[model samples]
Target: MLTSAILAETGHAAPTVPGLASVIPFVILLLCIAILPLIHKTSHWWEHNKNKLIVALSLGLVTIAYYQMRGYGIAHGDHATDPGIRTVLTVLDHAILGEFIPFISLLFSLYVISGGIRVKGDIPAHPITNTVFLAIGGLLASFIGTTGASMLLIRPVLRTNSERKHVVHTVIFFIFIVSNIGGCLLPIGDPPLFLGYLKGVPFLWTFKLWKEWAFCLVVLLVIYYAWDTIAYKKESKQDVTLDETRVTPIGIDGKINFLWLAGVVFVTGTMDPTKPFLGTGWTPFPFLRELLQTAFVGLSLVSTGKGVRAANHFSYTAILEVACLFIGIFICMQAPIEILNLKGASLGVDTPYKFFWATGALSSFLDNAPTYVVFFETANALTHEPGPGILQLLSGHFIREDLLIAISLGAVFMGANTYIGNGPNFMVKSIAEHAKIKMPSFFGYMGYSVCILIPVFCAVMFLFL
Candidate 1:
C-alpha cells in the first residue's frame, strides 16, 4: 500500500504483488546482518561501512532489478528496462524517494545538530540519578523525538555511568525507554504516529493514548530502577566510589543548537504536504522538508563551536551505517509489505489484542511505519459502513477506537523489540559500541526484550490494550 502521493505519481492504483519468493533478498540481508557479525570469518569483514555498503546495496539493487524484470518498476511494462537508471522506475523508487530521503535527512540533521550540543559533566551514577536521567529522556523524547532525544542524551547517560562495571543493562534499558517506548505520547515522537497524523488523524487525537504511553513508560522505568539497583550493589567497591566521586557539575555546551533542534521539530511537525499545517499550504515539492532539514545540518556544522563534539567524541559513522542498511531494508522489504497489504485482513486479527500483537510482531522486524499503515488500512477495510464493534474516532475516521489505540501502542512501543525495530535503536547501539561498551548481538538483544519487554507488554495487553 503506497501512500496516495506515491500512487498518484505512479499513475497506478495497485501494482501486481511480488510473489512470496521475492522476500528472499530481504531475508538474506537480515540473516547476514544477524549471523555475520558473530562469525569469525565475516566479523572483521563486516566492520567497515564500505563492505557493509557492498552487501547492502548489492542485495538492494538485485531486488530492484528483480522488480524491474517483473516489470513492477516500469510504467505498465512487462520486462526490465535496460541498464541506465532503470529509467521509468515509477512506484518503487517513487516510494523510496518519497520516504527514504526524508527519513535519512531527519536523522542526519538531528544527529549532527545534537552532536554539536554536548551535555558534559557526569553526576552521581547512583540508580536514582540514572533513573531520573532516563525519565527526563523519556519526557524529552515525545517533544524532541526519540531520535533527537537519544542523540542528545545517550552520551550523557554513558558518561554518568562511566565508572560502573555493570553499565550494559543501562544502555539496553535506554534503548527500551528513551529510544522506543517513551515516544508514544505524540506524533512528533515517532514516525508511525506522524504518518498517522498525515493520514488525517487529527494532530492531538494521539494525546488520548497517554494511558498506554504512561503505562509502558512507568513499567519500563520501574524495571530499570530495580535492575540498576541490583547491578549497582554488585559493582566493585572501587568502581562505586569512582562513580560517586568522579562527578562534575553538569552543564550544557554549544547551547545555540537548541534553536536548531527546535527548527527541526517545527519542520517535521508542520511540513506535511497533505495537510495545510500551520498555514503552510500544500507543498508541491515533496522533498522541501528534507531540503530544510539538510539546511539545518549545514548550519549546525558551520555555526557550532570548534571541538564542541569532542566532549562527546562524536562521529558520523553511526548515521552512515543507518543510511546504508535501512535503504536496503526499506527497498527489499517491499515484497513483504505488499504481502501484508494484501493479506492482512485475512490474518484473523479482528480484536484489539490481536491487532496489537499482529502490528507489533511485524513492526519488530519490518520497520514500524509501513507496518502501522498496512494494519491501519486493514482495520479501515473492516469498516465498510459502520458495523458492530466499529467506533467513529474523534479525528473522524471510522476505524474502531480500540483497534486504533492498539495499533498505535503496538507500533510505537514494540519497536524496542530488536536492534532494527526503529532507526534510533541501531544508532543507540552503535554509539554504545563506539564507546567501548560490549553491546549484545542481534539475537542477544532480543533475549533481553523477550524476557523483559514481553511480560510488560502482556500486562499492558490485558489491562489496557
Candidate 2:
C-alpha cells in the first residue's frame, strides 16, 4: 500500500503524517555499512577507510534516529489541527536539504587549501610591526570580509612567529581580534551583518559600530603587542639567530587558486534561502545559473590537481571531519529551532539592549545565522509594525536606527565569543591545530573570551553601543 494511505488507514490524521522520505539517507548509510564487509566491492570502498566509514555511518544513523524520535511526536501529535507537517518538513528542508549536504564538499576543499598556504620569509623585526599588522588586518577584514582577511594573512602571521617558542598565544589572540572582531565595521564582513543588509539595514549602518570595533582593536593590539614584545625580548635575551636559509617568498608557490576560492565564496554567499536569486530586472537563465555554479565548483576542484597540488600536498581530512560532524548537528538542530521559534516571544525578552545581549549570548553558542533569525523573530513579534520594535506616535518610531545598529553589532561581534560561534572561527582553530599549534578546550576557549573579549565588549556597551 502507499505510505500515506496506510497511515490514513491506521487512523492517522493529515497532521500526524511524518516525513518518512527524509530518513532515506540514514537508511542508505546504515545499509551500506551493514553489508560492506560481507561483499568484496572495490568501488564501494573507494579511498575511504572502511572501519572509519562504518563508525561515521553508525554515528550519522544514530543522530538521525535521535532527531526523528524527538520530532516523531510533533508529527504524530494528538491535535489534528496542529502545524505538525509544516514543522517537520521545515526541519527536513532547512537543516538537511538546505544546509548540510550542499556546503560540506566546498567547505572541505577550503579547509585543505587553507592548510596549504603557509607564509615564508622574515617579517620586519620591528617592535610595532605586529600592531601595525593587526590594524591593517582589521581594515582588510572590513572590506573583504573576515574570512578573506584571515585566509590571506594567517600564513604570514604564522611564518612571522615561526621562530618563537611562545608564539601560539599570539596567533590565538590574532584569531580572537583580527579574524572575528574586525568584521564589525561593514555589513559585508560577517553573515549577521549581511543578513541585516538584506533586511533593509544600510551597508553603512555597520559604521555605527566603528567606535566599538576601534576600541576593541586598540585594546587587543596593545595586549598582543605587549605579549609579542615580551616574547621577542625573551628570545633576544637568548642567542637566537635569524634563519636566513629558511626564508622564502611569502606567496604560494603554485598556480593561484583564486577561481576556486571565489567559487567557494560564491556558493556560501549566494545559496542563502532568504535572499532572492532573481531580481526584478534582467537575469541569468535559471537552468544556466545552476549549471554555471555546478561547473565552476567542479572545475575548481579539478584545478586543485594542477601545479597547486605539488606546491602543497592537500588532503581533505580535517574539513571532511567537520562536514561529517556538522551534518548531524545541522540536522538535529532543526528540532530546537522549531521549538525556539514557536516559543520565542513567550520568553519575555524586551528592549533593544535585552535583545542585543540575548542574541549575542546565544550566537556565542549556536550557529550565528539561525541565532540571528531567532532574535529577529523575537524582535518582529515584540512590535506589530514593519520592524521588530515597539510602536511609536508623532512621526517618529520609539526604536531608532541606533537601537537596530546596537542589536546588529551585538549579534555580529559577540559571535566571536567561542570557536563554534562562527563557521570560520572553528575552521581556523582546526587548521591551526592541524599545523601543530594546540588549541584550547571548549571551556578553556571561553576563559580567553571572558578574560579579554568580555571587558572590551562591556566597554563598548557602556560607551558607544
Candidate 3:
C-alpha cells in the first residue's frame, strides 16, 4: 500500500494488529457503561466514579496482558529504538497521549472555564424562549465547543424552566441539538471533526457541511417548538403563570472567562502540530498544546471568582467520569479500530450512505472519535492512491469529499443516539439529573433517540450522504 510505503519512507511504525478476541474487553467495557447503570442492584454502584475507574482500568489491564502474552511483552532496553517497544509506544501514544490527553485537556479547559461563567436569570421558559436558547446553544457549540456550550447553557436552561412541570424533553432535545447535532461545522465543534483537523484535514474545511447542519437544526428546532408548545399547554396553569410573572433580566457571571474561552478557540484553531496555522509545524513536542491548554485552565480558575462556579452548580464529577471512562474506551478500542483499518475495504461499505450508517452505528456504541478514524481509513482504503482532495493530510493520503462528509456527519450527528456516543451527552445527562430532573434510563434514552433522531438521519442520508 502506498500509505504504508509512505510511512516506510518516513520511518513511521506500522500498526500492530491484534487478533479478533482482543476486542472482547472493549465490547464488555462499553456494555458495562450501557447496562450496569440500568440494573437495580448495580446502578447505584455504577454511579460512583471510583467504581467506574476500577472497571475502566481493569478492562484496560486485560488488553495489556493480552499484548504481554502475545510475545511483544518485554520492554527492557531503551523503549525509543526497540521494535517491541515501538508497538507499545505507538498504541499508547495514540490511545493515551495522542488521543486521550489532548482530548481531555480541551474538555477540561472548556469544562472548567465554562463552569466559571454562569447565566443568571429566570427568564420565562416559554416555548419560543426555550427555542431561542437552543438556537443560541447550537451556534455556541461550534465556537466554544459542544462541551462548553452544554456546560454553560444547561444551568440557565434548567433554572429558566424550573417552574415548568414537563422539562425532561427539553433536556433531551438539548442533548440532541446542543450537545451533538449543533457542533458539526468546525473542528472545535465535536471530537471527531477536531481529530480530523488534527490528523490532516484543514481547520476550515468542515464549513462545507453547512447545508446539512442547517437542515438538521431547522428540522429539530421545528419539532422542538411544536413539542414544547404541547408540553407547555399540559403544564399546570399556575406554573405557566408563575413562569410568565417571574421573568428576570439575564446577566452573566465570570464575564472574563469569555476571553479565556476565546483563548481556547484560538489555541485549538492555530496550534496544529501537523500543519500550524501561523508557522512551521510543532509535531516534535506533542505536549505543547496540552501545556497551553493547562495554562488557560489555570488562567480561568484565577480570573473567575469561586462564587460563580458555585452558582453554576459546578463539580469535577462529570469531567472525572468522562476522563476515567474514556481512558479505558481509548485503550480497549485499539483492536476494533485496527480491524477496521485492515478489513474495512472488504466490508461492502463502498457508498456514502453505507459509510454514513456504518460509521454512525458503531459510533453510537463506541466512542465516535476513533470510529471516525477507523472509517476514515476505511474510506482511504477504497482509493489505491491519494486523490486530489481537501483531506490533504498525513503523507498526502486523503479520501474524496463525498466520503469525508458522510463520515463526518455520521460521527457528529449520530453521536446523539446514546449517552456514551459523544463526551457531552453523558455530562448533560449528569447535570440535568443533578438538577433533580429524572432522566431516562440507558435504553430508555435510546427510545427518544430512536423515535426522533433516526428519521431525521434517514432524511439526511437520502438528501446529503
Candidate 4:
C-alpha cells in the first residue's frame, strides 16, 4: 500500500498488489525496442511497424486499466455501474492530460525554434577545431535543452567533418557530452531536472552539481580529443590532400530565433505551482508556462525567414518521429511507474550508493523524468517530509544530502547509457543517419556506452557519491 503522499504525488490511487503480470507490457516494449532492430537486418521492419508497436503497447494500457478497476471495486465496494469504462478514462486522462501534452509541447517548441537558426561556414575539420565545437555544444546544452542544442549544432558539426572518413566517433562523443551529461546543472537543461523543479525543487539548487558536471566534462573531453587525434592521423595517412581546404569564418542566419529561444528558457524557468497564472480557483489545463512556450513556437515560425530554414535544411521528420514514439512510451510506462510507487519503499534503498545505482539503472531504459520522481518520492518517504517543497528546504536536516546528490547525478549522467535513455539521443542519431553517418544500431551503441561511459560513472560514484 502507498502512503497518501505517494498517491497525491503520483496522481493514482492504490491498486491491488501489483504482480509480475503488471510489468509485462513495459518489459515487452523494451524488448521490442532493443531486439527488433537486431532481428531484421537489411529490412525496414522496425520503421514500418511503428504503428503496430503502438497498438501492441496500448493493449498493455487496457490490461492495466481493467485490473486497476477490478482492484478498486473489490477494495471499496462497487460504487460505479461500469468500473471498466471509468478506469480507462482515468488512465487516459492521467497519461495524456497530466504528462504527454506538456512533454511533447516543450520538445516541439525547442525543435522548431532551434531548427530555424542556420550557422553557415566551411570550417576545416581539424582535430583541435572539432574538439572546440563539441566543447561549445556542451556549454550550449545547459541553456537550451539537449534536444535543442543537438538539433542546432549537429548540422554544423556534420558539415565540418564532411570530408573525414572516421566521423562516427565524433558524433558519438557529441551525443555523450552534449545530449546527456552536459545538462546536469540546471532544471531548464534536462527533462528530469525540469520535473524536479515542477515538483518543488528550486531552479538554482541543481547548480550545486557543478563539481560533478565539470569532472565528467573534463574527463570526456580529454578522452575525445585523444581519440579524435588518432582517428584524424589515420585518415590523414590514407589521404594526404585533406588539408588543402582552408577554414572559413562562420556566420549566423535567423538570429531572431535566439530571442525566441531565450523566451522559451524564460517561460520554463518561471513555472511555479504555488502561483498559478490562472489563479487556484480555476483548473490548470495547459498551465501558463506551456502556453507561453507554444506561443513562442508560433512566433518563431512566422518570424524566421525561409532562406534561413533552407540553408539549415530543416525538416519536421525528427520532431514528428519523437511525437509518435513518445505518445506510446508515456502510455505504456504507467504500469511500471505504479508498480514502483507501490513497491519502492520496500526495495532496501537506504544509502546513497543504493539510490544512485537503482535510479540510474532504470533511467538507462525508462524515461528519466518519471524515474526521477519515483526516487524523489522514495527519498521523501525516508525523511517523512510534511509536504511538497523544495528539497533544499524540506530535506535539509532530515534527508541525507549525499543521497539526493547521488540520485541527481545518476539520473542525469547515466542517461548516456543508451539511445532511448534521453530524448535528444534518438533525434540526434536520426539526423546523423539522414546525413549519411553510419550510426551503430541499438545494441552496438550500448556497447560503446558500456565500454566507455560505465567506467567513468563508476569513478564518479567512488569519488563523489
Highest TM-score: give the candidate number.
Answer: 1
Ranking by TM-score: 1, 3, 4, 2
What are the per-residue Cα lDDT tens digits for candidate 4 across 136-206?
88888888988788888999898788778889989899999999899888888988888877766767888
Error of 1 at 122 (Å): 1.2
Error of 3 at 178 (Å): 0.9
* Cα lDDT over the full model 4: 0.76
lDDT of 3 by residue, 1-465 (tens): 112222211123443445789899998998898889889999999999999999999998887666545644222122222334344555566688677887899999999999999999898898999999999999889988999999999999999999998999999999999999899999999999988876678778889989999999999999999999999999998998999999889999899999998998888777765564476554434566777888999999998889999888899988999998999998888767767766677789988899899999999988788899888877876665655654555557667778899999999999999998999988889888888999998788999999999999999988887
What's the best-to-worst order under lDDT? 3, 1, 4, 2
> In candidate 2, where is summed lDDT lowest over 10 consecutive residues?
1-10
* Poorly placed runs, candidate 4 (over 4 Å): 1-15, 48-70, 73-83, 236-247, 277-285, 385-399
lDDT score for residue 419 of model 4: 83
Of candidates 4 and 3, the better by lDDT: 3
The pairs that clash in candidate 1 are none
TM-score of each: 0.91, 0.72, 0.91, 0.88
Off by over 4 Å in 3: 1-19, 71-86, 280-284, 384-395
* Residue 380 shift from truth in candidate 2, angstroms: 2.4
RMSD of each: 3.6, 8.4, 4.4, 4.7
Q: Give candidate 4's error at residue 360 in angstroms.
A: 0.7
- Relative to the unseen true structure, what is the C-alpha lDDT of residue 102 in candidate 1, on a scale of 0 to 100? 68
lDDT of each candidate versus the true structure: 0.83, 0.58, 0.84, 0.76
> Higher-lDDT candidate among 2 and 3?
3
